[model samples]
Target chain A: MDFWTLANALATGLLTGLVYGLSALGLSVIFGVIRIVNFAHGEIMVMGMFFALIMFRWLGLDPLLSIPLAAAILFVFGYFLQSTVISRVAHLPDHMQFLLLAALAVMIVNACLLIFGPDPQAINISYSFDSFDIGENLIIDKSRAYAAIAAVAISGLLLGFFKYSRTGKAIRACADNYLGAQVVGLKVSHLYALTFGIGAAVLGAAGCVLLLLIEVHPYLAPGYTLLAFVIVIIGGLGSMTGALVGGILIGMSEALAAIIFQPSMKSAFSFGLLILVLLLRPQGLMGKSVK
Target chain B: MMGLNLLADLTLRGRICLLIFLAILISLPFWSSSYIISVTTITLYLAILGQSWNLMLGFAGLLSLGHALFVGVSAYMAAYLFSVLGLPPVIGIFPAVALAVLIGMLIGYLGFRFSIGGVYFALLTIAFAELVRIMVDHMGLIGGTEGLFLQVTEADRQGFDLINLRGHPWMFYYLAMLLAFLTLAGCRTLLKSKLGYYWQAIRDDQDAAQALGINVFRYKMYAVMYSSGIAGVAGVFYAFYQNSLFPESVFGIERSIEISLGPIVGGVGSLFGPVLGAFILTPLGEGLTEFTDYLQSSGLIDPKLKLNGLKLLIWGLVVALIVLFKPAGIWPWLNEKLGFSRKEGE
Candidate 1:
């Protein structure tokens, strides 16, 4: 295709990948901390988007402004969800968790359906369609640009927190050694809730960022779930760098594949890439190889 | 201790119960309402598919969310054979199952050899299923996205050949029953064999099993192939019964989820759980569909209520509830409550 067209696709792909990375980061954090797959993660993220969308309409708050509120709400939900429901089932046999989470996903989606219905809803910002032309070769949508900025900012913030903060260190400590962490006086139960809260909050931010590009629909959750999953695995599970790199790789590959092959096969292509990456490096790109 | 005797006598009592159950099933078509019969037919199909999935997820402990791949592949194989080569379905089904088994073995080889299990393994399987689905959707040879419908003609009427395949729901129903029965019996037989012990040992402790000199990979592959073969047979029955094949319907994620639901909800790694789960959940699913349809028809609920997502919601909720409340599943919980413990070759 033309340079402008290719650039446009690449930029969009990058944005999409970054968003995927952010969400995958959330998923990885939860998986690393809790050891449950959190199959409802995608649905929860979608719920965040819908929640943000509703807030934007009701109070006329901007999507960006609504992110923290959405995050706070979901944080509480996640905290309770883990402490009450997920944690109890987490230590059970594998299939129990799978079924439990899958079921919870269904409930959330249905609840969304019951409340929101199935029609696609978009937050109507006058500037939603606004964009910028860079040089003679590229045009970037304003909303996507904002989303990309937010993604970078969020990723940086999360990275900084994880590396420097005491709670973040405790979280890492727990992931590395649960008994050791507890022995060192890190309250394990509260830490688990906090980890889940952080994960949910991150996903909430990602959801708001995602809503900038695509309209909200309940069915969209599963698709996002699979996408985040692919990115996380490709990037290396529970690795922040992996999530970032995996997201971008997926976004670019999906965009390029859509251009080269059929658009419907976007997911298929991502999955194929995931399998290839997994076969080559099961531990993921930035993580130590697990044998 | 008393309950233990009841459980001890269950293997004998269970057979008689199954025989009576079979007799009732055979007579169901005769006495049951047409609506119930149709529902039963679909349920039987689900039961067969669910049982097939149990062979992998339940026995081998490989959690698959792409089982619809086997089901869809088998359906497409049957359809392609019948429409293109004019092969009799009876013969077509055998090869379809064979092909599906081979495909399963390939996937199992890749998965086990490369050491992908848990969510990663589940994702790989999902990817394979999605790839096949996308290919089928675009491939115009089998009617593409619009789907393929088989023409029904008489076995012998003037110049037309009639296969007697159409409008014969009972035949397919009986076939499904036979397959389900065989799967149940086959699973029981397999579980009591050396291979079954190997699978359990591997599931319980992979490193330990390997340490004990078990070829963990080979046994896992065999489990995958067997489960896939059984799923293919279900697919064959599914194609013949529906007389139509669409990539979306056959190879959908919903189908994959439904297959796993039975074994998980019933009780993974246990006999009788999947069968009971199918019996319970299949009807519930049909009832939900009907309720949605009723709401749509009566104009009492939003038209969107009849849409695809609600069923997903229900299925997901059921799974979650089962996990939350009955982690070991109804049968396993009951078995435990009655004081049944693992015995050595009892």
Candidate 2:
């Protein structure tokens, strides 16, 4: 009933939604360009979170500070994985490709479980408890606000890179028409690997940001994977801008639902929304209508 | 049995092999240990579920990741009816299957009508299952998160209550075997029918099938309905056998994955693949659990360490290797090893 409580939840949801948008942006970019959905996207993101956590424990580094390292590590892994394993299945049937990724997801999640055990892992940042007064009685958690700001900055950088950089433009060209790119002497396969690397890197950065909001556990991989898929599908599977918007919308809905009803209703609201989108607007909010 | 010549195409050697296998299964409880009986019961349950999934995936080219939606919904329906409404599962299973067919049609219609084939269709089905799961989790009428437990009495436990589908473990084992055989035969019959041919055409190439004058949409719907109907039966068996229903255990992605693995591992597109897959993977799963228990009991590992994830991890590796090296599955390879080879498309 209180105005500020509702306002604060909305604000927090907006912030968390931005981070989710960034995470989904990773999935969207790869699909848009390579036309291959990274079924193990969430597992890769979880690995990034564990990377951040490991750095925090060993070197007393903030998760935000470890973002670059995690991104770099996952980038290399993603690049190699696509070139080696995923490339083999890129031309296979859709279900086979999905199975391959799910298999990878299984391997990654269990590997993490074996290494870190099945317990929830989190970090203690000094600003976790700190909040900022936005005006009136409304307040936003400092870490959340910082995460949102970082998310926006990273997303902006990605957009700029895509819009202006040579490699980014080449990736876009490939997305538009890879055969054309290959005919023009572009190394399509290497570019595909690069695009996948960038996708993994973005997911890694988002994972680092997510560590500020929630704890990570090995079992959480599938849920996050499903959540990411929901976001991308809602945003229009291959649309980057739409993915961000969809994430925001999903986060806002879940936050409001949590405030209004039980927290368990969050998934219900999101999934229901997904079904509606799939039925009524398969192209998504910002995607062009497909013929 | 239906005059479709179900085994006319099968070789005499294959028929004999099947007869021997059937004999072993029919007499398993009398000679096998209690543990093996229970394991075989679980395996048979999984085989039917896997077969149902394979109908859509392998036969119709519909890759549904949430086939457990049928299993979960039907199981919940029967469980709720039997426990809350005092209806026996025999009748309860009817409504359960009806709902599953309706849901399957809705999913198929949405995906097929909207041109959402491939992975998008898969996601659509997942959304339905997850939505239902969350809804069931909040509804207290079905026990919500606390879960539904079907009560068992001394008589129900010690005696064979075929009417109620409750009794000694061996009774349930026999029930599972019977259901498995029934479903296997049903799937075989369907596969050899006109509907199965249409389904195969669609799976091989939809545009080509349409060009050839096949009613693609109608046949695809039939595939979904028939597949889900079988899955519903398996769900009823699950509700009675387990005597417990939790949304997560039944409706979650894990169950869906577990059900799909047998066909993928055994040999997708083959009639016996799901059974072979169930026979192979279920024992491995049981062995993994037994190994973990042994390790814990022998004090070879830390008590607090949860090694259960490794079992799934191994499955992941197996699937990945299979996808890479043995895309056809294990059954066909096994057939070759056994000095018998299937004719193309057989």
**Reference-based TM-score of each model:** 0.92, 0.96
What's the residue-level lDDT of B152 in candidate 1?
Answer: 59
Query: Each predicted complex: what DockQ?
Result: 0.55, 0.70
Residue B110 in model 2: lDDT: 89
DockQ of 1: 0.55
lDDT of candidate 1 over B1-346, digit per residue (tens): 3223324435554646656877889999898887887778777777777777877877777888899999888888888888789887778988899988987997889988999877778878887888788888989998889998877555322232225344555666666777777777677778768998888888778999999999999999999888899899888778867879999888977679888888777777776678778887888878888887888889887775446667757766676777788877777776556533343124
lDDT of 2 by residue, A3-62 (tens): 888888898889999999999999999999988988899999999999999999999899
Per-residue CA lDDT of candidate 2, range B175-294, in tens? Answer: 999888888778888887888899999999999999999999999999999999999999998998899999999899878878888998888888888999999888987887788778
The lDDT, on a scale of 0 to 1, for candidate 1 is: 0.81
lDDT of 1 by residue, A1-291 (tens): 777777888898998888888888899888877777777888989998998889888997778888888889989988998888878876787667777777887788888887788899998787888989888778888998888888889889998988899989999999989999989899998899988988999999998888888899888887778788888888988888899999999998888888878788787788888879777787788776655
Candidate 1 chain B least-lDDT 10 residues? B155-164
Worst 10 residues of 2 chain A by lDDT: A282-291
TM-score of 1: 0.92
